[model samples]
Target chain A: MNHKELIADIAGKIDLTKTEVEHLLDIIVDVCCEQLEGRGSIGMQSFGVFDVKKREERLTVHPTTQKRMMIPPKLTVNFKQSSILKDKLKNVPS
Target chain B: MNHKELIADIAGKIDLTKTEVEHLLDIIVDVCCEQLEGRGSIGMQSFGVFDVKKREERLTVHPTTQKRMMIPPKLTVNFKQSSILKDKLKNVPS
Candidate 1:
């Protein structure tokens, strides 16, 4: 599902219009980004946690060129499924 | 941040009350999970994508007992950050 579909699905379940749901989604994304950019995490019970992890710089050599290069340390966002969600997924026949 | 604090933060930024925001969040979570439970994905432009991945069952040895065991296959949720968000994070000083 894309953004529009997700928004429509959400709006359909609630009393808000599509536009209002879209706005709400945008705000939620903004808030999440702000929190993650600060290296913090967002935890929702029975849902999951969104966290920011920093990958340390490392040295690697090109496979073909055989040249060494430095990879700068960078930040990344990770989502860990909550145990509750994990259990729910486990219960589904794979 | 915890769910309550996150909800309050979002509520403060929008016209919606805390209760309304909480309800909205719940529906969003539910929709996302529903999509994921079907092994589908949700893509939010300039934000990221949430996908369901399946890890094949594997055999492993117990560390202390040295006994072999079978690990069941499981479904997991993964979030891949968008390049826009990655760039934004890169701009932040480490």
Candidate 2:
């Protein structure tokens, strides 16, 4: 599902208009980004946590060219699902 | 930040009340979980993608006990940040 489909799904599930839902999502993203940008994590109960972690600078060889290169350290966003969600997903048909 | 703090932040940013923001978050979680449970993925523009991936059953030995055990195959939720988010995260002080 894409953004529009997700907004429609949430809007249908509650007493909110599509525009309102979209706005809510936009703000949610903004808030989460702000938190992550500051090296903070967002933990939503029964959902998951979003965090920012730094990757150390490292040397690597290019796969095709087999050339050595230096990769600069950078921050990354990561998400880990809550245990409640994990339990719910345990029985998903493989 | 926990769920309530996040809701507060979002409410402060938008015109919505705290209760409404919380309800919206609940519904959003429900919808996302439903999509993931069905082995589907959710893609939000400028945010990130939530995906469900299956892990093949495997065998591993306990670290201390050194006893081998079988690990059942299960579904897991994974998130990958969008390039826009990644770009924003790049300059984060490491």
Specify the highest-TM-score model's number. Answer: 1
RMSD of each: 1.0, 1.2
Lowest-sum lDDT 10-residue window in model 1 chain B? B85-94
**lDDT per residue (tens digit) for residues A1-94 in model 2:** 9999999998898887999889889889999988998999999989999999888999999999999999999998889999999999986777
Q: lDDT tens digits, residues B1-94, model 1?
A: 9999999999999998999899889999999988888888999878899998889999999999999999999999999999989998997787
- Model 1 in CAPRI terms: which quality? high
Task: Report chain A TM-scores, every model.
Answer: 0.94, 0.93
The weakest ten consecutive residues by lDDT in model 1 chain A span: A85-94
Off by over 4 Å in 2: none
lDDT of 1 at B30: 94
Interface RMSD of each: 0.9, 0.8
